[model samples]
Target: MSEEALEYYKAAEISELQDGKVHSREVDGELICLIKLDQEIVAFTDNCTHISGPLNQGEFDGCSITCPWHGARFDVRTGKVLRGPARQDLYTYTVKVEGETILVGLPPA
Candidate 1:
């Protein structure tokens, strides 16, 4: 890892999150959501665009996440707000892999 890259949290692993499961993690004080959809890895912000609800507790479809509080849906790969009440998209981080570990890059400070 480069000197500057060390400041952020890298992808830990290719985690196996079951179908309909929501995983929330905090990286550098930023809340992230890791969702496993149809055997694919998708990441997004854990905060809802509407009412700031906990998206980590939301329901997961193939590539869509439904917010628990207001039932807002978003696309994980593109962070696009699918169904609303919410018009703002969630922030996305880049992901990489190092050996058996998955690496995700955080925005530069």
Candidate 2:
């Protein structure tokens, strides 16, 4: 489905996220990670590509997050695999901020 046709779900409020910190929220029954960098908010799958580790509990360095379980690294902005044991990239979502609300976009069901 086109991005324009994807369903946008409410994930968080602006006040709930701190700069350079990761937060977890459930959207449409799927858990996702949201990180705020400066004034931009980005979204990614909560699981690590290597061993399904929890990305929300990982270390975030503003631009990238390192999986706590296996030390795998991924770019938070694009969810691209940066370091291994993980060869597969993560699934990133389109994020939109409206007023105090943060919304994550997923493909149409």
Candidate 3:
């Protein structure tokens, strides 16, 4: 995992996130979803694997998120695909929260 190149960017603020919900944020012009799992913050691409559904609008029950478009389910913590129509797992980002800011690391362009 450390072999991949990454560039960390400021993704969101703590005030913009809430528990039991997913937040879609535009970081460096790319859409990413921020979620809280077991008191830790994690991030993933906002686009769902099944037909590119907007995952931020989906139902998040604190652990798993259900896609609103095709009912695909995903574990918010590991970005694992739980149920399908979506055979591919969502892409996760390395996240580090500093004070009130959330930083997400993405591959360099």
lDDT of all the models against the reference? 0.75, 0.91, 0.86
Clash pairs (backbone) in predicted model 2? none
TM-score of each: 0.80, 0.95, 0.90
Query: How do all the candidates rank in terms of lDDT, highest first?
Result: 2, 3, 1
Deviating ranges (above 4 Å) for candidate 2: none
Each prediction's RMSD to truth: 3.6, 1.0, 1.6
lDDT for model 3 comes to 0.86
CA deviation > 4 Å runs, candidate 1:
1-8, 15-20
Q: Tell how far residue 27 is off in model 3, in angstroms.
A: 0.8
Query: Lowest summed-lDDT stretch of 10 residues in model 2?
Result: 1-10
- Score residue 64 of candidate 1 by CA lDDT: 83
RMSD of 3: 1.6
Residue 78, model 1, lDDT: 92
Return the clash pairs for model 3, or none: none
lDDT (tens digit, per residue) of candidate 3 on 49-83: 99999998998885888889999999887889999
Candidate 2 — number of clashing residue pairs? Answer: 0
Worst 10 residues of 1 by lDDT: 3-12
Q: Provide the clashing-pair count of each candidate structure.
A: 3, 0, 0
